[model samples]
Target: MSNLLAKLISMKYKGKSNIKEYIMEISNLASKMKTLKLELGEDLLMHLVLISLPAHFRQFKVSYNTQKDKWSLYELISHCVQEEERLWRDISESTHLSSTSQNKKRKKTKGAAEGSFQQKKPKKDEEFTCCFCKKSGHMKKECPKYATWRVKKGLLVEPTAK
Candidate 1:
């Protein structure tokens, strides 16, 4: 019986487990202890349950503690069940909101990429004629003779377009 109580004290709540199921397990253990000629107080059992809750319920614990009226086991269970529902609802809503926002962002990014593509200027290449030499395949700034002259004049040479 002491071992069972020790186990109950050591048990901790996990977020992945159903909260109601966890409470049922506690009730079963307490009942077993009772059948063994040991009686556990309601307040002590409630406190034990509270202490065993996961860290995610820290805020709930704070709120519960701040309440003036001492709650019975049934009252605590009702509040906990309500809290569990609230927790799951918040999780589902946040997931849906995030997915919607992510899809919007992806569409915006795709549209921006397409817009930039259309705005891109034609590539400068061999198709262009050099203004200086009247020859094909280059620009005015890319004339070899002009570049040599600039170098001789101690002026920096402008790079030719490939």
Candidate 2:
């Protein structure tokens, strides 16, 4: 870092690099270094993240908040990181349900392999009747849609489309 700072200071303008651009380049370098360290250890980055906010209120040596009363840079950052960590933990816990879902799905597939999820329908009579339309030619076993149509019209409850 000392060597990099010395190099940056020793750099000549030569009408080639703008002053703002040079300063920004230095800033970018510093941020990259910080990011590398943060990846290595979150506590280090977390501490800095909490302390990054500005101190807008001060009463002599002590500070006070004029708006909501309580405030400080480090405290604000700590709160933010705490909330963020809590949110992440909640999300991870919720996704754990998906693993249970996968397990349930596996059990269902295993039950299916055992051939217990299916039932044999009774043999159809010579003549069948439609439950909804009340026709005699086709049975309710043939057309699920027609059987559900009357129920939907009468009670306003839709059966599963599938």
Highest lDDT model number: 1
lDDT of 2 by residue, 1-162 (tens): 555544534544332443334434544555565665622133333233223322321121132223344444345445444544555587788799888999999999999889889754546655666776678777665666764765677854566768
| TM-score (all chains, Cα) for each model | 0.67, 0.32
- In candidate 1, what are the lDDT values of residues 1-162, reduced to their tens digit? 989989889999887787878888998999999999988998889899999998778888999899898898888888899898898899999999999999999988998988953645447542777667788776678788778777888897666679
Q: Global CA lDDT of candidate 2, please?
A: 0.50
RMSD in angstroms, all models? 9.9, 16.3
Clash count, predicted structure 2: 1
Q: Which stretches of candidate 2 lie over 4 Å from their true place?
A: 1-70, 121-162
- List the pairs of residues colliding in candidate 2: 50-77
Query: How many collisions between residues are there in candidate 1?
Result: 0
The numbered model that scores best in TM-score is 1
Tell me how candidate 1 scores on lDDT. Answer: 0.85
